[model samples]
Target: MDRRRVIIDTDTAGDDTQALVLAALSDRIEVEGLTIVAGNVEFDHEVENAKYTLGLAGKADEVPVHEGIRSPLQKEYETAEYVHGEGGLGGELFPDTGIESADAHAVDYIVETARENPGEVTLVCIGPLTNVAMACKREPDLDELLDEVWVMGGNVNCLGNVTPAAEYNFWVDPDAANVVLRELSTTIVDWGVTVRDSTFGPDTLGRIEDAAEDSEFAAFYDTITQQVRAFNREEMGEDATTQPDSLVVACLIEPDLIEESGEYHVDVDEREGMTRGYTLVDETGVLDEPANARVVESIDAEGFRRLFLDAVIHGDPERSLA
Candidate 1:
């Protein structure tokens, strides 16, 4: 099987860290590079956090991390420190390994990488869409090179996490999100209803940790569990946490785990005050044009968890957590 080449644009939140781990450990996905944006934390912190995360995943040398935009094109960046904590990894600290940084700008990196592997690169964005949008603006021909863009933003049929109508990723940078949703030919894993319906709670986390105990990926899984527990205690006031990015990662590694509906014309609300960054879908079938994106509506939770565990374990039944 030909592995899918991918470039991840993220903010290194706890959830984003989990997604990185999944991508690094998966054989089906070849991570071309990582671009850090300003969301979940500041741009510098996000870049450092991406390095730390890839180091933790034991792929720091294989992936080049680049720092992208410091703020949105229009609105000021807002972070969910309450959920991701001060350090953006649930306050967990790791020693800096001083990895070499990317020499080129993130936009340039995205364009160059896509140009090198035309129609084979998949842009998996799990945070604010600033970098991808800016890259598209800088290189208008990127649309022809990209095979697909899997974005983890927008709320199609569910309530928003930031505002009553907007999801956190889009709400942080509505202008950037709007640019990507409108200009790029991509697929959006809608947060509105898809995420809420496909949650990985305590049972799944415990299974993952248990499975990790016998694999070389044990340490990675353990670290992720600790962060998840902290996030749960701080945000949900419980010992179990539900990870959103984990779901996105699962979708990437195993697209069959997610059941999708028909394609739809999705738009982001950029108006000020109310409904900013909300993803409004034309569900009535009144639009004359064809749908630009294949929107994911639901996922098979059990299958997704199994794939996640398999990716972590990688058939090493004797993997030791220690």
Candidate 2:
């Protein structure tokens, strides 16, 4: 099978790092490059996290990292350091991999790459949609150039992560999210999926801890996930930590993992109030609008954990984590 061509756009915090590791190590996807955006933490730190993540898969020199928008398109930048910690990797420090970002601006790189590979590239956006919206505005035909865009943001029918009415990525830059969702053929793997399906609790955590003893990658995963696990348990009242980004990536790598999905007219609310950045998914067809995106509502949680462990521990997805 032809490996899916992908470009990961990330904010590069704890779970974001896990997502990158999944994309980089899996033989099922060809990571064209990584575009860093402003969200999870400081912009520079996010860029560094991307480099460090690539280094884990021994793809440091092969995959190019490009720095994108430093702030939201129309709002001041916001971060999730409270959840991710100061270093963006649970404050863990490591020796430099000597990996540097490409000199190209992320917007330019995104536009050029799509133009060069029309109908072939897929952008897996796991952060705020600033770079993507800007690129679409720059090249109006961008929607037609790329094959697909997979986004890890928003919420379908439930509560959100960042706010009671909105998810973090869409909340950070509602303007950008609106632009991209309106203009692109997109698939949304929302916060609902993370909360409802792919959460890793104590049992799975113990499995990873056991795998860490024999796999350096699993050790890295175990180390970085500590902070988020605590926050999830204490703040969200959930004993499990959610990896939204990695779950979205897994759906792309293995489509069978998606247990349920639907096509809907999905848009983010940009108005100020209690509902700012709230994803207005027309799940009931109240809008009578044509569906513009596919919304993934659920996935096989067990399969996701298996896929994640297989890749992180064995560096391949063919092996069974169970």
Predicted structure with the largest TM-score when compared to the true one: 2
Give the per-residue lDDT digits (tens) of candidate 1, residues 1-322.
6787899999887778767878887767788899988888756767888898788678888999987888888887578766666677666665666887888888889988888889989999999998999998988888888998988888887788787898888888888887887778887776753455556666766776786767645455566457557766776676765556767767776677777666888778877778888887887778766677777777876676666566566732112211
lDDT of 2 by residue, 242-284 (tens): 8899998888888999989999998889987789889999989
Residue 176: error of model 2 in Å?
A: 0.4
**For every candidate structure, what is the RMSD over all alpha carbons to the true structure, in angstroms?**
3.6, 1.6
Residue 134 in model 1: shift from native, Å? 0.8
Show pairs that collide, candidate 2: none
Off by over 4 Å in 2: 320-322
Candidate 1 — which residues are off by over 4 angstroms? 208-239, 287-290, 313-322
Q: How good is model 2 by TM-score?
A: 0.97
Give the CA lDDT, 0 to 100, for residue 306 in model 2. 88
